[model samples]
Target: MTLPVSARMGGLAMAFRAMAYWLVRYRRTWRGTIVVSVANPILFLLAIGAGLGTLVEGSVEGASYLAFFAPGLLAAAALQNAFVEAGFVVNSALRRERIYSTAAATPLEPGHIFAGHLIFIALRLFLSAAAFVVAMALFGLIENIVVALAVTLAATLTGLAFATPLAAWAVTVADFPQLNTVFRFVVMPMYLFSGTFFSVEQLPGPLRAVAYALPLWHGVDLARTLALGTATLGMSLLHIGYLTALCAAGAMIARITYRRCLHE
Candidate 1:
């Protein structure tokens, strides 16, 4: 069963509409969220990069820790912002506030609710990335102005891809305890092992396979390579495809779960 052309377009329009709603409504959070996410990456850069740079004594990359760390900090924003937005906002609305019931009663629908959440998450990731780019400029992490915007766009998409399961899972959670376990067992492992802070080469041979298996790995690879001015066009498209597929699968699964839960 293939979707008709008109049906596909209409579905896309609805998703876009849902996303737009969150973007417009959350403009007020911009200033403060930016402050937190912006400072976070910087703190990581300084604490892990400079602090550890002293201990390594110029052996890790034969360069300053700042240079090696800029990419890691950028990738960290993708993981952090996406996770925070998904866990915090989704859990609050679905678990704490029961806002979804109210929203579901409206014309927006559950799918729209999901889109709205992802849109907000995507926007936050973009802002967080932008803030890091500025910090990078101050710290001399970037020389190419073009790569800054590229990194942000990549991070935005990648954030959504890596967060797909968490976002979808948020819809069906009977309680918050599961979320803690998911974060501890699933997301935390992805963050630590997915080349977020270091090269995948550092992974043990068996564990190296896990790095390539993660959506974040593709995103981080693309972001770092492009930001460094080394990636090919094909690589860029591959990363884009990976993120798109994850988002689509997530939305589809979420729709199924939401419809079953809400309609029943």
Candidate 2:
């Protein structure tokens, strides 16, 4: 039977309430996160984009090395932060703190709980991405404010593409060590090879194929294309489609996992 519109709205209200729990908890710890979100990009831009950038000759994709590298780093940083939140934070809530278990006792369904947490994650990504873009602008890497905003949006999308699926898996993990293994083997390799620091074309054919399949490469490419104003309509659509599909699929899996975890 079709539920009434009021019922749907009520569920969404519950989801937002769940999201509020994270936001309120974040108030005490937000200062540290804000510092890292702003400082990390500036330091990277100085070290990698400015320091190493000078040693490299010629422009990359018609811009200076700083311009080329900043957007990729922005996307990469989003991915890393998203993973940190989705990995250890989510795991702790499930295993150590049992926050989800407590919430399960409330009126919120598993889907609402997952949605609420995912909403908070998206907010976190937006703040970090915005800060990174401001840092990019300080380096004179971005000319157009609109493009900078687009790059920030692209980075946030890139983060969600990884965060949702990782959160889904985090629901099932029994310990912290498994999360470390994922970071070491899965996330680290993607960070290195996903066109963040260099072109994926430089990789061997098989490695290049692997990079192409990863969401980060698409994210880096999309963000870089926006930052450089080099994106064609077709390529932009392709990248957005891939990232959006991953976000949707991951959210679905996360909902299912949350249901199983909470119900059990």
Candidate 3:
């Protein structure tokens, strides 16, 4: 069942072609995205970080509330963006627009199509994360360039960890309402409770355990640690390992789901 090395390389090259297709299509649709990606972080920083931060500054340990809050927001924002790009969009391609179907009609295998789309999503995550980091800098939330880049990388990894599995599930969904439910029940709850707005330690024992189990908490913790310069090698590796495992597992699942959907 193993393909030759040349064949594998060719499949990857085809996947890149599929990514290029999305990149070109994005040229027309990117304006609205850019506005949201760039402005949401800044507005959140102003309203919540600066405004609510003042009220809770004394309660937060070690750093100002804004400083404590900004990195977590960056991680949460990346999660949101990745979900938006992967959820309904993946569903639309499989159902309404039939983009994946169209690609399947060509020589491309399902894995190539999936990889291409995933790559494009990763690119989007990186751009959005980088923009948010810059906004953090403008507000003096991030001081070091290396730290800013590390935070950005963490955000992007956090995003892919969610995006891959979400896309896998999106392919199996029957309608838009199902995706809506996921956003409402799943993504929204994580955003509100995943150590983004407050510390997980504030939760009761069971809730704290649940928060630790969620990917967003790991992401928020990693980004905050890097931003605050409080990262220990062991803890950083743990966060990275958790997110990386999710990303790898999700990609595997997506490949299987995509192959089924495309063949059907």
Once model 3 is optimally superposed onto the true structure by TM-score, how far is the C-alpha of residue 90 displaced, in angstroms? 0.6
* lDDT score, candidate 2: 0.90
Q: For all the candidates, what are their Cα RMSDs to the real structure? A: 2.8, 1.3, 1.3
Q: Candidate 1 residues 1-264, lDDT tens each?
A: 998999878766776776775677577666777655778778877788668755765543344555666775677677777777787667777768776676677776677777766766777787778877777777776777787788778877888886666678776788778878877888778778777677788889889997888887888878777666677999889988988899889878888876665555
lDDT of 3 by residue, 1-264 (tens): 999999989988999999998999999899989766667776887899989788883756478888889999999998889888899799999999999999999988999999999999999999999988988898887888999889999999999999999899899887789888888998999999998888888999999999999999999999999999999999999999999999899989998999999999
Give per-residue lDDT, candidate 3, residue 32. 81
Pairs with steric clashes in candidate 2? none
Give residue 100's error in model 1 in angstroms. Answer: 1.7
As a TM-score, model 3 comes out at 0.96
Instruction: Indicate the residue-level lDDT of 225 in model 1.
Output: 74
Off by over 4 Å in 3: none
Q: Which stretches of candidate 1 lie over 4 Å from their true place?
A: 1-36, 54-64
Residues 21-91, model 2: lDDT tens digits: 99999998898887666677669888999999999899776788888899999999998899888888899
Candidate 2: list runs displaced more than 4 Å. 1-3
